[model samples]
Target: MSADLIYLVLGLALLLAVVLPIALSRCAVSAPIVLVGVGAVIGLLPFDKYGLDPVSQQAFTEHLAELTVIVALMGVGLALDRPLSLLRPRSWRGWSLTWRLLLIAMPLSIAGVALLGWWVMGLAPAAALLLGAALAPTDPVLASDVQVEGPSVTDDHDEIEESDQVRFALTSEAGLNDGLAFPFVYAAILLATAGPVAEWGLKWVGWYVIAKIAIGVIIGVVGGWLLGKIAFRSARESLAVARRGEPLLALGALLAVYGLAEVAQGYGFLAVFAAAMTLRSQERGHEYHETMHSMIERLEQILTLMVLLLLGIALTNGLLAALTWPGVLVGLALVFVVRPLAGWVALRVGHRSEPIGVAERWAIALFGVRGVGSVYYLAYAEGQAVFPELRELWSTMAFTIIVSVLVHGIFATPVMRRLERIRAAAA
Candidate 1:
């Protein structure tokens, strides 16, 4: 592309970023849908462009998706109004929902999808496992409509009625599970490279699961605590920086913590999110949280637009050309069956005492919209090891994401609004 054309495209993207949120707010339409549609249309135009093959541009695709997810995670952590606690009955709801989704629902979803991919879609065991792990997490970027708004001064812990249970559940799940899914991804890589082994099992459990998770948590807590002191409760001589009210500090913190975690062989996703949560917990009612969240949110929005637009272009350019009837069935089953069933089982097992209504549980289960994160995992895995069924994997993931964006985006606003009304009446 020429400089003039590149400048034109950039200008148009900025305009859409400024206008689309306000325009889409009046209807059930979502910004993702619009951005994707525009990209598809542009792809059909007669402009000579570079191809967007995922395998060929693996690094670019992986890093772009990685950056978007980290920013979204930071925004999610900062926006949460509820405090994390283990106290029974009163303060345990958030932690309970998060644990169920991560421990029970996520593993079940991975196993179910892997089985379907192997049996129904004729994928190899390793490839099937990769697909399952990649699609496991509900996307943090494209789920904005279902997430809580930024920190509010009036948010109170005692007023449980003011909380949106569905949003809270989805947001917290997305925030944590993005990091949690990495171990499984690594497992798939191990199986592909080393095959099944007795010795590898012990190493995987100890190093991958126990050590990495512990490292991520420790770094996040200590890093967040130190940064919080610097940003909020600095000594008298260093208070001027805190008084400056610069939100870019949040971005710096995100990069710093994520880099440190990755260098330490820990999951950057967990560390970034944990750090954000710890920072938020330091001053729950502080106005600074809003500023930091808004900054990250805007950056995430821009990055999401770029990614989805490229995805649409890729779709139009034959990313799904290898899709078969069985692939389509597998994708549909994942959205309509696997996630909902796994989510139901997890909630039933974990929340036996404080049962959620059937409708609410189903609503939460049904809305696991997969987006950029899936693409990132696939690209990352493909870079790690060659998969003969690469096209099939991409086709299934693309089909599921397309269906999810349309189905979930259309229903999210109305469903959430109706749920809020029901809760209000009951209160």
Candidate 2:
């Protein structure tokens, strides 16, 4: 590829990223599917594409996935309209389904995948655990079609005006689970390097499971509270950024909160989300929320496009060469079996607590869309420890993501649309 052709390709990809969302808005197909296809086509041509090798260049892949995830997390947090207060009890009512999905469904999914990876795929315990932890969370980036569209400001702060349980649950689950999945990832790392569960289990439980979560939430809340004051309630006339109509504070706030939490040895993903939610809580009816959210959403779109393109390119250019029959089976099973079964089991609680019906529950169960977050987790884990089946892990994870993008991508729009119609009729 010539320099000008490279520039041309870059410009065109950027254009497609900006336009494809609107183009595919009414169709069953998604922008990700199209982006992947485009990249695959580009890969078919004779060009030097070794620079985009994910397996060889793990750091680049990890950083790419990490940036996309954090950006998407910020957008997800800002886009959610549901009000969640950890300190408030009644507020928990609205988040019952979310809680169930995170506490029950996510873990069950992880265990199921881990078992399959170990039993059927013949992976070691640590590799299986890493696979489980990586694929466990529903991604905030690619599942946008099924998530809350954006934040809706209302006068009532206590109100959780959630008409779509499917979107709300999936969105909130994606947001919190990205950070929540860290404990298990850490567990996998310990199993790999720190020895068996008997030795490191207690330390992992206390530090990775408990302390880090607390630290992340605290940093997020404190940082968000401070930023909220600075943005919305600053006593000084010149200091209130939200009052001054600067929406970039959303970007600044997410980065600051994430960076601070990580520095404090906390889950930065959780802190970014927590800060975003806290910042959103203030000035509930403010337009600044939209501005900040819009900025995050735009960046998220660009990053998602880039990642998908690279993934598509990799898919065509020997990314799957290490893939075997077992890898394929595990990947397919995760998409078709483990997630839906686990999600259904968890969503049984929804009947009594949530307003969703059978179809909605099934939709929620089946639409646990996996994307860039999985990539980030796998890449991050690879950096921390040496798994014997690292190549196989990459291939299997890539296969699962592609299948998910195709399967869930094609069906999400139609399924959610039908459910919306049903909800409207009931209303």
Candidate 3:
């Protein structure tokens, strides 16, 4: 209870937060799970005398998770080295994964959630839609663990030129889709408030879907282009900034674009990501790519640790109090069944790489690791809707996210190790 003891405790936690992640890096375990476990154990003790009131400020928990998610998005955007394109040769193979994730997997996932909401959970249609949208976007922070290492694997000029197909696509997709999933959440809110589907049908569809998506895209392209040009070439010493390797300029671009887009009512997530991609494309062969990526990645890792620890605190404090058995079953189904089936269908189109064959593809799909982003969306949606099922939905989403982090985190390193050996043998 003394100030000195409090400071000591804080210092110890901070140390664990840093060291545990590095120590667990190549193992099948993850920093998030460990932090959560520690927090839970600490909570179980009679620590109320320590004066840490975890329940009074749920808002703090939500905002911390939100900040962590957005910052991770910025880092994800900054790490992408490939130029944007619809064509396969010019894009990351993860691009196909992104496309399939959005076009097929996303919609199907939403529909599946909605159906379960209606039949099993007995949730209202609007509440069902909200749950769907909230759970849809895969969290970039957690995916970063399983994602391929940096944009350039080989230092060789010829080999380094080959775009990192998997990481780029997954990072970019997670960045943009977080915002794209918002319109659906908004639509659910509108439908909940307004009368029925037929009444506001075309009008609501146009405004939320067409108008919002358009505004987000336009703001992204224009804002990103302007910021990229400024960050990369506005000064008289334009080439000097580039030559000096100032990667913090990337952070400036992220804040500027995200802030401006939010002010204009466009999706800030889309804008931040678009700006990063545009900047990367400006000098695709620049040596500074790794410099910028390394800096952002470090910051992202720290933020991830803090967020996961807080999430663990919340779980210990009673985040799952309202969870039901059916809800638990639904969450498991999403992880094991829906995601794998979707990944299989998406990759069924085929790939040029044999190492990432059908079996590998299935593994990737099955491990659709959810984490902070899902937590943010669910919390944000709860503020928007208070349906009878809202509490249950929150519990289920939290349960699913925790399960995914533990299961996938435990297996990612081992599985990736195996896959790499397999690829090497085949080669």
Q: Pick the candidate with the highest TM-score.
A: 2
At residue 114, candidate 1 shows an lDDT of 92
Error of 1 at 414 (Å): 1.0
In candidate 3, stretches whose alpha carbon ends up further than 4 angstroms from where it belongs are 1-14, 49-59, 85-94, 153-169, 238-240, 349-356
Question: What is candidate 2's local distance difference test score?
Answer: 0.88
lDDT string for model 1 (1-427, tens) is 2465445446656778899999999789898888888878877777666666676778988998999899998998888877763233666665677789889999999998999999998899989999999998899999988888777644553542226667788889999888899889888888888788564888889998989988887787788878888888776645524466779878988899999999999988989988888887766666778888889988888788878877877888778888988888888888889999988888788577657777788888888888988988898888888889988899899998988898888998899888888888889
Runs with alpha carbons beyond 4 Å of true place in candidate 2: 1-10, 155-160
lDDT of 2 by residue, 287-378 (tens): 78888998899889888887887788788888888899999999999999999999999988656766668899899999999999999998
lDDT of each: 0.83, 0.88, 0.68
Q: Total backbone clashes of model 1?
A: 0
Report model 2's TM-score to 2 decimal places. 0.96
Position 338, candidate 3: lDDT: 73
- Flag regions of model 1 displaced more than 4 Å: 1-9, 85-93, 154-162, 236-240
Assess the local accuracy of residue 105 in candidate 1 as a C-alpha lDDT between 0 and 100.
90
